[model samples]
Target: MKVVVRVKLLPSPEQAEALQATLHACNRAANAASGVAFTTGATHKFALQQHVYAALKVKFGLSAQPAVRVIGKVADAYTTRTAHLDKGLLGHKGSKRRARSEATPIRFRPDSAQPFDDRCLSWQLDARTVSIWTTRGRMKNLAFTGSPDQLKALAEHHQGESDLIVQDGMWFVSATCEVPEKPLNTEPTGFTGVDLGIVEIATTSTGQRHAGRILNRYRRRQNRLRAKLQKKNTKSTKRVLKRLRRRESRRARDVNHMISKSIVERAERTGHGIALEDLKGIRGRARQAKRNRYTLHSWSFAQLRDFLTYKARRAGVPVVVVDPAYSSQSCSECDHTSRRNRPSQAVFACTGCGVVMHADTNASRNLARRGEIVWNAGRSVSRPCPSL
Candidate 1:
C-alpha cells in the first residue's frame, strides 16, 4: 500500500532562497514547455523533450533531470485536460475556434508543477535532511522534520519520490512510501452496512452513528467569518481569510481520519465485511436546492470512503460497494421501494410492513442485504459483488 506523509522542512536562509529560485526556474520552464507543446501540438513527452529540452536547461538554469521533469509535468497537464475536451480538438488546442473550451489554452501557473524522481531528489533519514537537484547543484542535506509517527515511516518504509510544496509561506515535502499491509485472519461473522452522509458522517446497520454536527457548525461559523472579512477587502484581512480556509480544511481532514479509523476498527473487531453505497460524483448529481446545496455540494464522502478503503486493505478486511439507487427509500423489512417511505430526512417508515427506523440505518440494512446476496452467490470468489 502507498501512503503519503508530509514532513516540515527547516532550511537555512541560503537554502530557502535557493529553494524558491529553483522552483521559480521550474515554473518558467514548465510554462515555456506548455506553450511550445500547445503551439506545435506536441503534448507527448518525447516530442516535447525533443522540441524544448536543451533550450530549457540553458535558459532556465535547470539541470538535465529538472529540465526533463518540467517537460514531463507539462505533458501530464495537457493529457489530463484533453480527456474533457472534444476529440477533434485534441491536437488543435492552439487553434482559434469559434468557442474555445477551458482546456484550449494549456497554461501553467507559477509554482504549479514540480516533480522529482530518485535521480533528482534523495531522502537522508539519518541526518534528518534531503538532497534536491537544483539550478546551482544538488542542495544536499537540507534540514527537515515531522511528527514522530511520520519520521518513523520515513525511516522504515520510505520507497518513492517526494514532492516539494510551498503553502502558507511554509516549505513541506510530501513523501510517498510503500508499506506492507497488516495481516488479519478472521472468519466471516456477518456484514455491516455503512451509510455515508452530510448530516452524520456515517450510520452503520448495527445502529452505530458518527456525528458530523460539530464540523457542520464549524463550517457555518467560518462562512460567516469569511463574509465579514470580505467586506473589509484589506491585505491583512485577505491573508487572515486564506489562513482561516486552510485551518478549516485541516479540521475537516482530521475529523475524517478519526471517523474512518473508528469505522474500520469496528468492522475488524466484529469480523464482518463492510458494505457501502457507491456515491462517486454525488456532488454533481445533487440538485441546486437553495438551503441544502451548500452542504451537499461540499460533502466529503469520497475522502471518508478512501480512508476506509486503505484502512480496510491494510487489515485484510472486506469492503463491498452496492448501488445507491433506492437504498434510502427501500424498506429493509418488507423490501418495498417507495418514495413515501422516507418522508423526512431523519425518519423512515415502511407503509407495507410498518417498520420504523432511522433513515440512514434503514439504508445501511438494505446495503447489508445486498452484500449477503453477493456472498451467497459466490462464496469462493473474492470479487463476489458487482463493484461500482
Candidate 2:
C-alpha cells in the first residue's frame, strides 16, 4: 500500500550542494549505526538514530532529536514488505553503508500537519495550504508542489493534510494514512500468456509481440560510448560519460514503462489474468558463452519484471508467475519434453504431435496452461467455472 511519489526538487545550486552533503552524512551515520547494531545486538532504528544525532549535532549544530527522527525513518524502510527479499536486503545494506554516489535526499515525519481543511480531502488534493509552527513564528500556507496525480494519491490515502518541510532541498512528508484497498475479486474471462525473451522483449499468446530492437540499439550505443570514455580518460570524456549514463538509464526506464503499461492494458481490456514465467533465480541460473557475457549482463530483465508487477497491481489486474521449468523445451501441444523441441531460438516443434509454432508463442501457451492449473487449485466446487 505504500507508494513513492518522486517529485523534482527546484533548489538553488548552493542548496543542492548542501542537500548532497546532508545525504552523505546521513548515509555514513546510518552505516556506522548498522555496524554497531549488528555487533551489539541493539535495536536497528535506535542505533541508527543515535549515530545520526551525534553526527548532525557535531557537523551542523542541528538538534539531536530531529536528526534521530530522520535516521529512524531510514531504518523503518528496512521493515517494509517487498516481494523480492534481495532488494530489501540490498536496501538495508545501502541505508547503513551507501557508496558516495548512492546517497539521496530524504526526511521523516511522525504525523500529518494541521489546518483541518475539507477541500483537500474532498477533491483528493493535498492541502496546498497548511500552518507550521516554526521556531520564529507560524508559517502559513506554504505551497506543496509535486505531480498532481501523486498529490491526489497522497490525499486519498491521508485524511488529514500535512505540510512537508523542505530541509536541505528534500521534502519530508508523512507516510500515507490509509492503506490501499485490496484488489477487487472478479472472475477472469480468459488468460493472457506472456513470454519474456532476450530478443523479443515480450510475446503474447494472442500473437502480439514487442520487439527489443530499440532497447538493444540503445544499449549497444551506451557500451560504445563507455568504451570510448574509458580509453580517452579526459575531463570532457568524463562529462560525456556522465551524460550518456543518465540518458541510457532514462531511456531504459521509459521503454520498460511503455512495455509494462501496454501489457497491463491488454489484459484489462480482455478481462484476463496475466500469466508469466516465474523467473526466480533466473539471472543466477543463466548460462552465457564467453562472448555473450556483456549482452547477458546488460539485459534489464529484473527491471522489466518489476515494472510489470507494479503496473498490474495499480491496474487492479492479477499477474501470476508460473514455474518456468522446461517452458521453452516442453511441447505445448503433445506435452512432449526434450531439448529437440526447440531446434532454434525462434522455432518450436513438438516431436510427438508434429506441432510447429513460434518459440515464444509455445512458451506463452505453456505459461497459460500453468496459470489454469493454479487457478483451478484455488477454485471451489460451489464457484462457477470461467468461460474460456
Candidate 3:
C-alpha cells in the first residue's frame, strides 16, 4: 500500500527562490495546457501530454519530466472536479450538457508541490540533506530534519514521489512510501463503535471519550483573534491572520492524529473491530441547532475517520463503517429510533428501553453493533446500510 510521509525540508534562501520560480513556470505551462485540454477534449493524461509536452518544455523552460508533470497536474485538477460523477453509481447517466469548453487560466497555488523524479530528487542520510531539480538547475545538498521517527522512516522504506511543498513559510518534502499490506483483517471477533462529534472528538462504545474541550476552546480563541485582526485591514494584520490560520490547522491535525492512534490501539489491544459512522458529506447534510453550527461545521470528522482507517489497518484490526442515519437518535439498547429520546446534545434516555446513557456513547454503541453485523456478513464496510 502507498502512504505519504511528509518531512521537513530546509533549503538555502537561493534554493527556495529557485524552487518558487520553477513552481510559477510549471503552473503557467499547466494553465496553457488546461485551456487546450478542455477545447480539444484531451482531458486524459496521455492525450494532454501529447498535446502540450513540446510547447511546455520550450515555453516554460521545463525539462522533459517536469513538463509531463504539468500535464498531470491539470489532468488531476479536472479529474478531481469530475470524481463525483465518475463513481459509476447505479442508474446514473452523465450530464447531457457539457461544461464550457473554455478553460479558465489556472494559477499555481504557492503550496503546490513540484513533482520529483529519481533523476531530479535524491536524499542523503549522512548529511540530512536533499537534492532537487529546480528552475535554475539541479539544487544539491539542501538541509532538512524531522522528528526522529519521521527521519527514521525517510531513511528506511521511503518510496514514490517526494514532491516539494512550501507551507507557512516552511518547506516540506511529501513522499509516498510503501508499507507491507497486512493480511486482510480476520473477521471481527467483536466491535468497538466510535461516534465522532464536535463536543467530544470521539466517544466509543466502551465509554472512552476523547474530549474536544481544548480543541473547541482553542478555536474560539482563534476566532476572537481573527476577528480583531480582520477589523484592522492592514498588511500586518493580514500576515497575523495567515499565521493564525496555519497554527490552528496544525493544532487540530495533531489532536486528531493522537485521538485516532489511541482509538486504533485500543481496538487492537482488545481484539475488536473499530466501527465508525459513514460520514460522507457530513458537513453539508447535518444540522446543529441554533448557536452550535460554527462548532459542528468546523470540526474535522472526516480527517479523524481517515486516520482511524489507516491506523486500524496497520494494526490488523478491521474498520467497519456503518450507516450514520439515526445513529444519534436511535437507542442502542432497545433499537428504538426517536428524536425525543435524545433530550440534549449530551444525554440520551431511551423511551422504549428506559436506558440512560451519554448520547454520543449510545450512538457509538449502535455503530459498534452495526459494524459487527456488517463484518459477519462479509461485506465491504464503505457502503452505507440504512437499517444497520
Candidate 4:
C-alpha cells in the first residue's frame, strides 16, 4: 500500500527558495508538455513523455535522469487518466482538454536535502528512524528526527503509510499504510443510508446527521476575503487570497475526515454497509435545475462519497452506491412512490401507506433496502430483517 508521511520542513530561507524554484520549474515543464500533447493529438503516454523530456532538457536544462523521472511521472498520470476515461470512471471532456498533471517534484521528510528514490517512491518509517532511497544513493536514520512516540502516533493514526509528494504548492502524501488485501468482513445485517446535503453535510439512514455549519462559516469567510481581494487587485490582496484558499481547504479536509471517520466507525460497529447515491450525473442534472441549482452545486456529495468509500474500505466495511431514482420520494414502509411523499425538506408523508417520517430518515431507509438487495444478490444469504 502507498502512504505519504508529511513533516514540516525546518529549512533555511535559501533552501526554501530553492525548493520553490524547483517546484515552479516542474510545473512549467508539466504544463508545456500538456499543451504539446493536446495540440498534437498525442494522448498516448510515450508521446507525452518524449515531449516532456525534450522540454526539460532544452528549456529547463535538467540532466538525463531527472528529465526521465519527470517525464515518467507525467506519462504515468496520462496513462492513469486515459484508463479512467476509457472505463467511464472519469468525466467526459472536450477534445481540446489539456492534462495538468501534478507530481511529487521534491521530497521533504526524514530531514531535508535527502533525494527520493525514483523507482521505489516510498519510504519505511519506524519508531526511531525513516529509510529513504534514490537511484544513486540511500539514506538511513537521518538524524534530528521528531519524537518517536509522536511519529508512532502519527503512523498509527494514518495506518502505517509513508510517502510525500509535492504538487501545486501542497504536499500530497499517502496518509495510510497497510491496505488490507480484503476489506474487513461485514455482514449485510443493516444498511447505513447517508444523504449528502449542503447545509447538513450528511444525514445517515440511522437518524444520525452531521452539520457543516462550521465548514460553511469558513467558506463564507473565504468567499468574502476573495471578493475583497479581487476588488483591491493588489499584490498583498493576492497573497491574502492564497492563504485563504489554503485555510479553506484545510478546514474542509478536516471536516471531511471527521465526518467520514464517524460514518465508518458507525458502520463497522453495526456490522452494516453504507448506502449512498451514485451522483455521477449530478453536475449535468444540476445545470438544468436553474434557480434551485445552488442546492446541488453547494453539495460536496462527491467528496463525501469518496471519503466514505476509502474510509469504509480501510475499516473492512462495505459501501453500496444505489440508484437514487426515487429514494427521496419513495415511502420506506409500503414501497409507495410518488412526488407527494417528500412534501418538504424534512417531512416525508406517504399517500398510499399513511406513513410519515423524517425525510432524511425515510431516504436512508430506502437506501438500506437497496443495499440489502445488492448484498443478497452478491451473497446467497437469507434476507436480513430491516432495522430502521
Candidate 5:
C-alpha cells in the first residue's frame, strides 16, 4: 500500500524565501497551462505539456522537470474535474452550477503544493535533511523532523515524488512510502460491528464505546469563535481564524487516529473481522435544522472509516461494510424492526420482543449479525467442492 509520511522542514529564512518563490512560480505556470488547456480543449497530460513546457521554462524561470510537473498538475486537475462532472458531483445536466464550472478555467493558489521527483529532490534519511532544487538554485542540507515512526517509514520505504506544501506558514514535505501488507486472514473467528453516530463516535458489538461529547463541545466552542471572528472581519481576525481552523483539524485527526488504532488492534488480536456501515452520500441524504446542520456535517465518520480500512488492511484483518438502513431501529435479539424501537437517542426497546438495550450497541450488534451472514454466504459459495 502507498502511504504518505509528512515531515516538517526547518529551513533558514533565505531557504524559505527560495522555496516560496519556487512554489509561486510553479503555481503560476500551472495557472497558465490550465488557461491553455481550457481554451484549446487539450486537457490530457501530453497535449497540455506540449503547449506549456517551453513557455514555463522561459517565462516562469522553471527548469525542464518543474515545467513538466506543472503541466502534469494542470492536466490532473482537469482530469479530476472531468471525473466529478461525470459523477454529477457539481450538479445534474443543464444545472447552472455545472454550466458555470465547465465554462471557467481552473486556477491555482500562489502557494499551492508542488511535486518534486528524484531529480529535483533528494532525501538523506540518516542526516534528516533533504537537497532540493529551488528557483534561486539547488538547496542542500535543509533540515527536517518527523515522528520516530514516520522517519522510520521514510527511511525504509519512501518512494516516488514528495510534495512541497506550506500550511499556516510552516513548510512540510509529504513523501510517499510503499509499505507491504501482511497476508490477509481469510478465515475469521467472528466479526466486530462498529456503529458510528454523532453522540458516540463509535460503539462496538463487543461492548466498547468511544464517546464524542468532549470533541463535540470543543467543536461547538470553535464554531462560536469562528462566528465571532467572521463578524469582526479584520486582518488579524482572519489570521486567528486560520490558526483556529488548523488546530481544530489537528485535534480531530489525532482523536480519530487513536480511536482507529485501538479498534484495529483489538480486532487483529482477537482474530475477528470488522463490520462497518456503508454510509455513502450521508450528508446529502440526511437533513437537519439550520443550527444543528453544523454538528451533522462536522461528524468525521468518513475519515474514521478510511482510517479503519487502511489499518485493518495492514493488519490482515478483513472488513465488511453492511447497509446502515434501520440498523439502529431494528432489534438485535428478536429481529423486530420499527421506527418506534428507538424511542430516544440512547435507548432501544423492541416493542415486538420487549428486548431493551443501548441504541448504539443494538445497532452495532445488528451490523455484526449482517456482516457474519454476508461473510458466511460468500464462504459457502467460495468453498471448494468435496473430494471425488
Candidate 6:
C-alpha cells in the first residue's frame, strides 16, 4: 500500500524566496515544454525531453535533474489531459468545451507543485531538515516538521519522489511511503454490508449508522459565508476566502477517517469482511432537484469508500463490491422486489412480508446477503479438469 505523508517546511526568508523562484522557473519551463509537445505531437517523456531539456537548463536556470523532472511533469499533464478528453470528461464531440480544450496547449500555474527525486531532494530524517536543489543553488538545512507518526513513516518506508507544494503561503512536502499489506483473511465469519448515502453517510448491515447531519450543517454554514464573501468582493474578503478554501473539506476528511477506522476495527474484531455498494457512475446517472444538487455534488462518498478499502486491506479483512441496482427497493426478509418497499427515505416497509425496518439498514442487509453469495461462489472450484 502506498501512503502520502505531508510535512510542513519551515524555511527562512532567503530560503523561502529561493524555493518560490525555483517553483516559478520550473513551471515556466513546463509551459514551454508543453507548447513544444503540443506543436510537435511529442507527448512522450523522452521525446519531449529531447526538444526542451537543454533549453530548460539554460533559460530557466534549472539543473540537470530539475530540468528532466520539469519535462516529465509536462509530459504527464498532457497524458492526463488526453485521457480525460478521450473519456469525454471535457465534453461531447463538437461541443464548445471540447473544442476549446483541443485548440490550446496545457499550462501550469506558477506555484504548481514540482516533484523532486532522490538526486535533487535528500531527506535528513533524524535532523528534521532537508537538503534540496534550488534555482539559486543547492539549499541545505531546510527545517521541516510533522506528527510523530508521519515522521516515523517517512523514516521507515518513504520512497520515490516527493512533491513540493505551496498553498496559502505555506510550504509542504508530500512524501510517498510504501507500507506492506497484511495477508488476506480467506475465511471470514460473515460480511458486513455498508450502504452509503448523503443523509446517513454510512450504515452497516448490523444496524450501525454514521449520520451526516452535523457535517451537512457545517457545510451549509460555510456555503452561506462563502456567498457573502463573494458578494462583497473586497480584498480582505478574498483573503478570508482563500484562508477558508479547504476548511469544510478538511472537516469532512477527518470525519471519514474516524468513521472508516471504527467500521474496520469492528469488522476485524468480529472476523467479518466488508461489502460496499458499487456506485461508480451514480453522479452521471442520478438526477437531483435544484435544492439537492449542491448536497449531492459536495458529499465525498468516494473518499469514504477509499478509506474503508485501504483500512480493510491493512487489517487483513476481505472486501467485496456488490451490485446495488435494487438493493434499496428489494425486501431483505422475503426477497420481494418492489418500488413500494421504500415509500419513504427513512422507513422501509415490505408489502409482501410486512417487515418494517430502517431503509438504510434494509439495503445494507441485502448487500450483505449478496456479498456472501459472491464470496461463496469464488471459494468453489468444483469444475472438471481440462484435458491437456
lDDT, candidates in the order shown: 0.84, 0.64, 0.82, 0.64, 0.93, 0.94
Superposition error at 49 for model 5 (Å): 2.5
Write model 3 residue lDDT over 1-388, tens digit each, in one string: 6778888877778888887887778777777888888788788899988888999988889898888777888888777656734653322464332222122434456457678767778988888888888789888888888788777777777887778787777888887777766665686569999998878889999878999998999999898888889999999999878877678878999999999999888888888899889888877787779677878777888888999999887788888789978988999888999989988889999999899989998999889999898888776557667895
Tens digit per residue, CA lDDT, model 6, 1-388: 9999999999999999999999999999999999999999999999998998899889888899999999989989988999999999999999999999999999999999999999999999989999999998899999999999899999999989999999989999999999888888999999999999989999999878999999999999999999999999999999999999899999999999999999999999999999999999898898999988899999899999999999999899999999998999999999999999888999999999999999999999999999999999989989888899
What does candidate 2 score on TM? 0.72
> Any residue pairs clashing in model 3, and if so which?
none
Estimated TM-score for each candidate: 0.87, 0.72, 0.88, 0.71, 0.95, 0.94
For 1-388, candidate 2 gives per-residue lDDT tens digits of: 4555433344445544543444454455455544444455444676656544666556543344435644554555444322223565435554654432134222223221212123321231345543333222334444445767766666666544332334423554443444464474357776788888779988988788988888888788788879978898999998777656567767878887898899888888788888888776766788989777777776777888888887777777777778888988988888899998888999998888999989999999889888877776667568678899
Candidate 5 lDDT over 1-388, as tens digits, reads 9999999999999999999999998999899999999999999999888787888999999998888888888999999999999999999999999999999999999999999999999999889899999999999999999999999999899889999999988999999999999899999999999999889999999988999999999999988899999999999999888777677777888899999999999999999999999999999999898989999998989999999999999999999999988899889998889999989999999999999889999999999999998888877856678999
Candidate 2, run of 10 with poorest lDDT: 112-121
Worst-scoring 10-residue span by lDDT in model 4: 103-112
Question: Judged by lDDT against the true structure, how good is candidate 5?
Answer: 0.93
Flag regions of model 3 displaced more than 4 Å.
82-107, 379-388
lDDT of 1 by residue, 139-246 (tens): 998989898989999889887777888776688888888878867434568888999988888999988898889999998888789989999999999989877757
Candidate rank order under TM-score: 5, 6, 3, 1, 2, 4
What are the per-model numbers of colliding residue pairs?
0, 2, 0, 10, 0, 0
Weakest ten-residue segment in model 5 by summed lDDT = 375-384
lDDT of 4 by residue, 1-388 (tens): 3334455333345444544555455555655665666566564667766556666777865555555555555555566766776765544453322222222122213221212333323334543433333322443443224446445645565453233345335433333434343456656578888877666788888878888777777777676778878999999988777666566666777788789999888888888889887878777865534645644565566777888888788777888888878898988899989998877877999999899888877887888889878777877768789999
- Ten residues in sequence with the least summed lDDT for candidate 1: 96-105
- Candidate 4 clashing pairs, residues 3+ apart or interchain: 3-163, 4-163, 4-174, 5-163, 117-134, 159-177, 160-177, 161-177, 184-316, 193-205
Candidate 1 residue pairs in backbone clash: none
Judged by whole-model lDDT over C-alpha atoms, candidate 6 comes out at 0.94
What number of backbone clashes does candidate 3 have, counting pairs of residues 3 or more apart or in separate chains? Answer: 0
